[model samples]
Target: MIIPEKFNAFRIHQLEDKQIHSGFEQITLDDLTDGEVVIKVAYSDINYKDALAATGKGRILRTFPLVGGIDLSGIVVSSIDGRFKTGDKVLVCGAQLSELYDGGYTEYARVKADSVVPLPKGLSLRDAMALGTAGYTAALAIQRMEDNGQIPERGPILVTGATGGVGSFAINMLSNIGYEVVAFTGKTEQADYLTSLGASKLINRHNIEMGSKPLESMQWGGAIDNLGGETLAWLIRTTSIWGNIASIGLAGGIKFDSTVMPFILRGVSLLGINSVEMPLSVRQQAWKRLATDLKPTKLHFIAPTTITFSELPSAFDAYIDGNVTGRTVVEINENL
Candidate 1:
């Protein structure tokens, strides 16, 4: 495993007019921000947030000319972090990569020692990237739900955005752990794919009418909602007594208009999952669970589609339009 002295990274530069232009650019090892370890990055994956950052649609980067990827997996070639050594395998997710810091879109990534996690034994590099932030969020959602008393024997668990990475993995993992999962998706065409991932039933996104009513009939025992706003509000209303709902993203919107009826009457718990600033112990625990108990048997069900660094600009458009499905991996450095 040879680490590149000079590497390629997808760099986003903001021009004077405040427009962002992103492309593949040559970068040197010395150009990366200082960190305790440098990884010979093998694979990186795109997330909805990554798409936003690349296009400058969101204020994803706190700085200019930043690398634009949120997740990475590979082997360590150098380490000042005593926990890691040369040739040791590892993967990093969250810990503000690509947000407040330079990140994984490059052939090499130098990250703070505290943010790195050793790759779990059973997972390959590809597997770790496949899980990436999406699967980690899914696990966090489920873990929160369980911590709040959700159980397989408690009727059905609903996973919104079912065709997307987080929802897809949530459905598969929840079902594999013995809970019946009902998936919600706008892509009706992906019905078979969702079912294959263990969704016991599918709800058309359009059919779940967003009413302003304070409460609705309790329909589900628990929910893992990636789309926030009205969908989350709706889920809260219809959740059974003592049910838990994990809110992970705002793909739908940021605001939620709901009343306290669900909480005060039904005792519904709305757990907010912040994958970015998770404690190191919890991060390690989640990855270990991803390698074991909460691991999805149909992990390849969310198989990644590879794209070169050069193709990112065009691929990003597709991502924002909700036209891309499953995970998309970028081949950063060569492996032989």
Candidate 2:
């Protein structure tokens, strides 16, 4: 295959007035930085962080005219490194892509060969992006929780922000792994969808809201929290003895008001999940789990929409507005 001299990208630029500009534009080979592998991007997926970078809401982008996508699955077009060669299917997510440099929101992505993962056996490229950073992060959280002594027999595991990408996949993966998952979401209307993903019980968001007292009745044995502020504090307060709460996101608020009582008295543990800057060895373990035991059986049911590259901008709006229900897959190179 002949690689093109220029390709299309969803570029984000910081303008002279200190504003953000993001949209699809043509870019050349000269635009990309040096890398050992040049991939023909097959598919990419949207994450909450990508939304922040695109909309200028979260200050996720550190440079201008940078392509803003955090997850990519594609085939290598060329490689200077011995680990991968031309035509090898690969995936890359959260090695600082779309932050300090251009990322996967393009027809082609040039990233260091060290950052890529050879696509795991038993998973398709489409399904890989369907899992994407969201699925991978969810996997990492559960793995950490299990490592810290969380188990299905301990009791129910609560998943906050259950309608979002990470939360949805968390519900599915945890349930598939034999844990009783309790999904917490403001969108109670999506209860059936959550149930189909194997949630044992669906709780309204108000249930976890900050209340007058700091501590509440003992509830879940473990939790995967995405909201991160008051909900996490509540998890710490309400979890069973020796329970674990893996905090995955800060979309609601960054800081939480809480004392150390939960930690000191109840022995509850808080695990922070970070997909970015994860070593490739750990990433491989996560992906292997994703392809096997932790793989969502009804992946398409969990993430139903697949959009063309042109529709990504509007999809970005829907994502920021909390209108997107599941993972939004963007097809960059259709042949894959």
Candidate 3:
């Protein structure tokens, strides 16, 4: 494959006024961050972090003038690394793209070979992006929980932020594996959508009274919590003995007051899930499971929207506004 001298990239720059400006620009490979592998990016996806970086709603980029997409799936154009070769299918996620390096929001992405994972069998380039960081994070959380001894027989699992991509995938994957899943969501109106993804019950986060107690009644065997702060504190108190609560996001608030009674008395474990900077073997194992036992059965239902590259600029707002239901994959170069 012959590489283009200049390709389209959605670049983010911090101007002299300290304001963030992002838009499409034609650039050469030399303008990108240093990497051993060059990819003809086939697909990228919208995540809340991607929206924050693009819209300047949050401080996600650690450097100026970087391509803006956290996840990408595509075919390798060339590789100096012995582990990968030209024409190999691969995906990159949770490797600090857009934050510390040029990301996937371009026709071509030059990425560190260490950040790449060979596309697991049973998943296409598009399918990989459909899963993206959201699906990968969900699978990682489940793997950590199960490794800590989480099981269906312990109790039903509660999934907060149940309509979002990670929550939706977690619900579907857990339910498929025999755990009864309960969705805790503010959008109770989307009950049908939640149920379709295999949620056995719904807890309206709006009306529930989370009492101020060191520990509360044990309602859940385990939990996958996306909204942190009070919800996390509540989960910490109410989780049954030996249950693992995987804390993935902090959309609610950062600070939360908690007592150790839940930990000391009940042995409830709170596992922090950080997707970035993971070991290569750990990253590969997660993707392998995402293709097999942990694969989401309702993938299309959870991520049915695929927009062209031209439509990418208009899509981030919905995610920032908390209006997006599931995942949205961006097609950068489908011909690749």
Candidate 4:
């Protein structure tokens, strides 16, 4: 692969007045953050965090300017690292791209060798981006929960924010592994959609009355919580004895009032799932599972949208406005 002197990159910059301005610009290899591997980026995907960073909606970027996209899949253009070389297929997710480093929204991406995973068998570059961070996060959550002794025999798993990408993947992956999966979402109109993803039941979040008690009647055996305010507190109080609750998002709110009663009285475990900054081995293993048992049976259903790189700027608003579901992939170099 020939490295171009200048290539197109969607760069994010903060003006002196503190507003974010992002658009395509021709940049050189030296313009990107330092990394050992240079990739010919094939596909990138949109996440809520990407939307926030690009639009300055939520202050996701630590630096003034960077390329925006948390996940990517591509072929290596070059690597100083011994483990990777030119023409190697690889993917990167949750490695702080667009947060602390220039990310995947470009024709070329320079990334840390430790953050890259060789494209697993059975997943093409586009398929890898389709799964991206959302799928990886869901797999990490389930893996952690199961590590903490979660089992289908314990009881059905309740997935909160079930219509979102991570929640949707969690519901499907759990069901495919023999666990009874229940989806908790405010969008009851999408009942059929949730059910098709293997949700055995739907709990309308808007209709349910969460009691204001430290410990409510035990309902779920375990849960994967994407909302972190009142819903998390309720899940903590109502989870069955010895159940695990994997906390992944804070869309509801950052703070949640809760007591240690669930932990002490019921022996419940609250596991926090942080996909970023994981050990290289752990990150690789997650993608390995995503290629096999945890591979979503309804992958296309979960991430049905594919947009050209030119269409990337206009796409972030839907995610910011919360009008989008599943996932969307951005094709940067389709022929790669």
Q: Quick one: best lDDT, which candidate?
A: 3
Per-prediction TM-score: 0.96, 0.96, 0.99, 0.99
lDDT value, candidate 4, whole model: 0.94
lDDT of 2: 0.88
Summarize candidate 4's per-residue lDDT along 236-276 as a digit string, tens digits. 99999999999999989999989999999999999999999
lDDT, model 3, position 278? 88
lDDT of candidate 4 at residue 97, scale 0 to 100: 95
Question: What is the C-alpha lDDT profile of model 2 across 236-314, one tens digit per residue?
Answer: 8899888999998887789887778778888889998999878889899999999999999879987788899998888
What lDDT, from 0 to 1, does candidate 3 have? Answer: 0.95
Cα deviation at 238, candidate 1, in Å, is 0.6
Lowest summed lDDT across 10 adjacent residues in model 1 is found at: 327-336
- Report lDDT (Cα) of residue 222, candidate 4: 98
Residue 281's lDDT within candidate 1 is 94
Candidate 2 positional error at 63, Å: 1.2
RMSD of each predicted structure? 1.5, 1.4, 0.7, 0.7
**Across residues 136-181, which tens digit of lDDT does each residue of candidate 3 receive?**
9999999999999999999999999999989999999999999999
Candidate 3, number of clashes: 0
